[model samples]
Target: MDTADRLIESTRALLWERGYVGTSPKAILERAGAGQGSMYHHFSGKRDLALAAVRRTAQEMRESAEERLSGPGTALERVAAYLLREREVLKGCPVGGLTQDPDLMADPELRAPVDETFAWLRERIAALLSEARQDGALGPVLDPADTAAAVVAVLQGGYVLARAADSAEPFHRAVGGVLDLLGARVTD
Candidate 1:
């Protein structure tokens, strides 16, 4: 890839691995195999490059979710598919992990992608739940908005729990519990 693309990709990995504060320009340059001059030539500075990386990550997260959510299935099935999709559990949700980064959240520019990603996810899930409710796929008592937030919370919190326990079981259990709560069946 080109130097700029390399830089952006390297930054994206670093941000996911190290968070915004831990990802340094020197490390990004080293990872990208590009020199300081090449970095500067491609982007203004660290923040600029980080923003690009974050935006790319956010887009990727959304697209991946859309793929699963829009696939052939009932609303609950779509959501279950998303929650059960294979992931690098210990590494955490790329966008959700960023929410814990104080430095990243402090900067409006840096935080925008993270904020937008969660907002989009919540809205998409809410819409799905609404569709399910309308079709009587979901129970009458379930509120789309509240259930959406709970689902996201469980997933995000599951990551934290898994990380804390240093095992994937917690994450799986959390997902299974949420599915149980929703009375969603696991169909092939």
Candidate 2:
């Protein structure tokens, strides 16, 4: 990778491993194997590099979700595919993880990608649920928007629960529970 690419990738990993407050320019340089001058030459500073990283991460998250959520299957099946897709559960959601970073969250520029990602995810999931309802795959009582938010909450909260317990089991169980709930709402 080029110096700029290396820097952005390193920053992304650092941001995931360490929050914005914890990810230092020096650490970024060290991780990227780039010189101090390289970072400055490629970007203005740490924040600039971080913005690039966050944007990249957010874009990737959206793309991955779109692929699964829009893939072959009924709406419920697509949702199940998304929920059941393989993930590094212990590491947590990259964008979701950023939400815990006060320094990142306090900065609108830094937070924009994170906020936009979740909003898009919620909307996408809502659309899928609405499709399912329209097709009679789901019961009439299901609220697409509210249920979509719950689906997101369960996934995000599952990360926290799993991280807290130092086990992926909690995450799996949370996913399974949510899937069961959604399944129960399925119409015959």
Candidate 3:
């Protein structure tokens, strides 16, 4: 890839592997195999490059979710598909992981994409739940908005749990539990 692209990609990986506080411009340059001048020439500085990386990661997360949630199936099936989708369980959610970075969270520009991504995901999942309720695929008792929020929470929490334990089992169990709860609410 080109210099700018390499820089952004390297930053993205660094941000995922190391939080904003841990990811250094020097490390980014080393990872990208680019010179110091290349980073400055392409962007203002580390923050500028980080913002680009964050935006790209957020966009990718949204696209992947949309692909899974929008696919054909019952709403419950789609939701399950999203929850059970392959992921780097130990690495954690790229966008969700950023929320743990104080430096990143303190900067509104850096935090906006992360906030927007979760908001969009909750809304999208809510829409799916709403559709299911309307079509009698899901029970009417479950509130779409609340359940969506819970779904997002569970997924994020699963990542934390898995990371803490240094095993993917916690993540799998959490997902399976959520799926069971959702499945129980599905109408005949």
Where does candidate 1 clash, by residue pair?
none
* lDDT by residue (tens digit), candidate 1, 1-188: 99999999999889877888899999999999999999999899999999999899899999999999998889888988999999999989988888888889999999999889988999999999888888788877888998999999999999999999999999999999998988852223
Name the runs in model 2 displaced over 4 angstroms.
none
lDDT of each: 0.91, 0.95, 0.94
Which residues of candidate 3, in runs, are more than 4 Å off? Answer: none
99 Cα displacement, candidate 3 (Å): 1.0
Query: Model 2 misses residue 38 by how many Å?
Result: 2.0
Steric collisions counted per model: 0, 0, 0
How far in Å is the alpha carbon of 64 misplaced in model 2?
A: 1.4
Instruction: Give per-residue CA lDDT, model 3, range 112-165, as digits (tens).
Output: 999999999999999999998998888989999999999999999999999999
- Where does candidate 2 clash, by residue pair? none
Query: For model 3, what is the error of residue 23's alpha carbon versus the real structure, in angstroms, after optimal superposition?
Result: 2.3
